[model samples]
Target: MRGRTVVEFHGEIDIATTRQSDQHLDAATARSAPSVLVDLRGVTFIDSAGLGPVCRAWRRAVDRGGDLTLLCTDTRMLTILRLTGVTPAIAVTGS
Candidate 1:
């Protein structure tokens, strides 16, 4: 919404899913000044592999003068992001 490309991720996000997630994220952040929103509310589990794509996407967005936001209401996910030092680099919102 709001002229942004919204990517929603569900279920477990681990090594197995990173490649696909990376592809989508890469596409979402390809254009200059692209605005992307990654919805992670449906995610139940995530690991370092999953976070790698997120961080890369954030970097790509910023490098292209764009921005990427994460939508996650799950406490566990939020905690993981925080502990992993990912929250500081990306904007996260919920509901």
Candidate 2:
């Protein structure tokens, strides 16, 4: 049953850890879950590579009439996104 996949990632996630994050996201995509909740409460860092996959996931959700909701409990990640000015582009919650 393809349903929602809630992926919670922690620790530093930058270009160095992109592949690792990608692997997780790819697994979620492969499942094609109806809804995906990416919780970034424990994330210590995130580069474009890390952000790209989420955007891609959002697109995939839209394409499939599904939804991708982002829940972030880390302020550091929010700052990075604000500075990058891509938070609005991607659905994010809890700055």
Candidate 3:
């Protein structure tokens, strides 16, 4: 919440949806010190292709002196993020 731009992702995140996801993430992280919250609780599945855009967004936010947080309670998604080393890089919160 707060002043962060919240981007909620739903369904499966795979190669088929990475392009669109990337576009959205890029736009969200385009400004200076953009605080973004990526809501992934609605996501059912996610692959490495899906994580690419998220990592990129996190980097962009950090480079701009901002930050990105991930809100996910799904065990599968959380595991994927942990296994991919994204949990340490991005702030993750669960409900």
Candidate 4:
């Protein structure tokens, strides 16, 4: 929370939320900030479809030479991230 540029994905971010998430992800990329923190604290569930937005956002940030980080991931979410080998890519902390 706080001042972090948090993107809280509640449910699945499939075709439904893809447009909105893309907007946020694009904003995160366009900003000339040093870093962008996408807090997933409020997210209760996710799937590969949901992960698409995350990857898109991360790629956006990287394109702008900025860093992307996520926090407040639950066990299931953590497993997904770990299994996908993205645990090392995003700076995950304080789950």
Better of 3 and 4 by TM-score: 3
lDDT of 4: 0.73
Better of 2 and 3 by lDDT: 3
In the range 1-95, model 2's lDDT, one tens digit per residue, is 56678888888767777777777766766644357788899887788877877777777776766777788866777888778766776778763
What's the CA error at residue 7 for candidate 4, in Å?
2.6
lDDT, each prediction: 0.93, 0.75, 0.92, 0.73
Error of 1 at 3 (Å): 0.9
Q: Would you estimate the TM-scores of all the predictions?
A: 0.95, 0.78, 0.95, 0.80
Which lDDT tens digits does candidate 1 get at residues 3-91?
89999999999999999999999999999898999999889999999899999999999999999999999888999999999987798
Question: Which window of ten consecutive residues has the lowest lDDT sum in model 3?
Answer: 1-10
Regions of model 3 farther than 4 Å from truth: none
| Residues 1-95 of candidate 3: C-alpha lDDT, one tens digit per residue | 33889999999999999999999999999999999999999999999999999999999999999999999998888899999999887989995
**Residue 78's C-alpha lDDT in candidate 4?**
86
List clashing residue pairs in candidate 1. Answer: none
Positional deviation of residue 33's Cα in model 1 after best superposition, in angstroms: 0.4
Query: For model 4, what is the error of residue 84's alpha carbon versus the real structure, in angstroms, after optimal superposition?
Result: 1.7
